[model samples]
Target: MPARTYPALSYELYPPRGDDAEESLWATIRRLEDTRPDFVSVTYGAAGSNRETALTLLRRLLTETALKPLAHLTCVGSSRAELTDVVERLIGGGVRGILALRGDAPDGVDPSEGDLQHAEDLVRLIRHIEAPRTAQLAAGRVSVGVAAYATRHPDSPSEEHDIDVLLAKQQAGADFAITQVFFQPADYARLLTRARRAGVTIPIIPGVMPLTSTRRVEKLGSLAGIEVDASLLARLEGARSDAERRRTGVAATVELARAALDHGAPGLHLYTFNEHAAALDVLDALGLERPPEAGTVASL
Candidate 1:
């Protein structure tokens, strides 16, 4: 295969909750547009709390931006019928790709509340979904992706079980997998090794998040069942100011990105947290935001 001319870059965004926040989000989107990510995704809330918001963002992205939007559909609190309706809405809105997920249950609720039990089930549904009469299905069908956990998912029985779930997703029709954010690239490597051994051949992209807020990132990581490197945390905590800490975080992200690509990972799926400055800075530092050559797949 020929070497890639430019690295593949993608971003994740969450819907804004209020007027001020919405304004901020647009500004971020505008800035990110300049960087020209391969695609951008909007996250669905846990238990489907923000499904409409996510849909609206996707629609606006299709019309208002140059970015390709990936809609996230989760089996959080939706029945099979309801899930189908959501997919129809996306197709109607011209979304060409979806990230199928088994999202987190709302606080104090049971995960079993949803009709679709697993990511694999959602993936299968998306693969064979019949488009509603009102909508235009992009490219005849939507491209589907599923999440991968470098470490064990919080609800998974073990690491092996989580890997099995990912393999099942591929069998169910996922075109690729984007891993949860992890501190160590080695964890992603281990996950990929196990996946390949299990006969999974689809692209698996490493999710990268630049740590700007030490406390907030740690808390979020813990909630997602991600392991933190103690020494790394200690180093961040040692920074005398927020600026210094962010600089350290950016440096670390660049290092991690290099490791993932060097290890044969397909690309970087950055968790932008609805912000773009830090992620853009990291990409610029890594010299990965340039345009790809013609005929290149732009995945590296």
Candidate 2:
């Protein structure tokens, strides 16, 4: 059969710590699963500290539910051999897709000595594994995806340079890209145009993070280099109570999702931040319910 296509809805999850965290994560997973997300992803902790936990969670999902899991793999502080071993392990575990990254350095570590600097380098390395056995070991084929910045990357001098870097990753064999979260729909529209101009044709999914609280949203925006638009900033600033801010935030996220889909974003990738209620509320507002199967969805 031809490959299926759907307006994808995906969520990102982080590795949990103890009993409470694990319970909360499962609760969130079930809540999101009810919406029939296209896929559910689990993140690797800083320096891959939770790599094993992520793997365990992937196994749990595979055995318990029908959700396809995308494990986030980072290159920081890992040698090529180390990454190859991890890839081999995931393949053996039946995981078929990865979100490759050159992760942020752990605090106080000098980044220059790391084995992988750019995500494209990781993509190139994975590509090598898919080559002939005489050249390298085959880890079976894995769908490789990379991160993109809809707004200018914090380290980039200009948006053009950022798009160029993303295009390089796509050329290096990244199958798709998931963007950093942004509040403004226009930013993603412009970024998509720039990427196409730079000749990157892969599906670019727009990342969305529901703002549960004003303070938390502001802090996240500062860290990600997203300029909370003046109008949004004003609305949040003016909200007299926490309830008002949350209401406004949900409204804003729903509006943003509508605009993104209108602009042809291939899908919506939500940063769950280990919570589901707000994200579910936003998805409901967009009229996006869960899929019958994990990754495929029926038409509205």
Which candidate's lDDT is highest?
1
- 52-116 per-residue lDDT for model 2 (tens digits): 99989988988897788998999887777888888777766777778988888788776676788
Question: Model 2, 287: alpha-carbon shift in Å?
Answer: 0.6
For candidate 2, which ten residues in a row score worst on lDDT? 131-140
| RMSD per model, one decimal | 3.1, 3.4
Stretches off by above 4 angstroms in model 1 are: 1-5, 130-139, 292-300
Model 2 TM-score on a 0 to 1 scale: 0.90
- Per TM-score, the best of the predicted structures is 1
Locate the minimum summed-lDDT window of 10 residues in model 1.
130-139
**Model 1 TM-score on a 0 to 1 scale:** 0.91
- Give Cα distance to truth, residue 216, candidate 1, Å: 2.3
For model 2, state the Cα shift of residue 173 in Å. 0.8
At residue 124, give the lDDT of candidate 1: 82
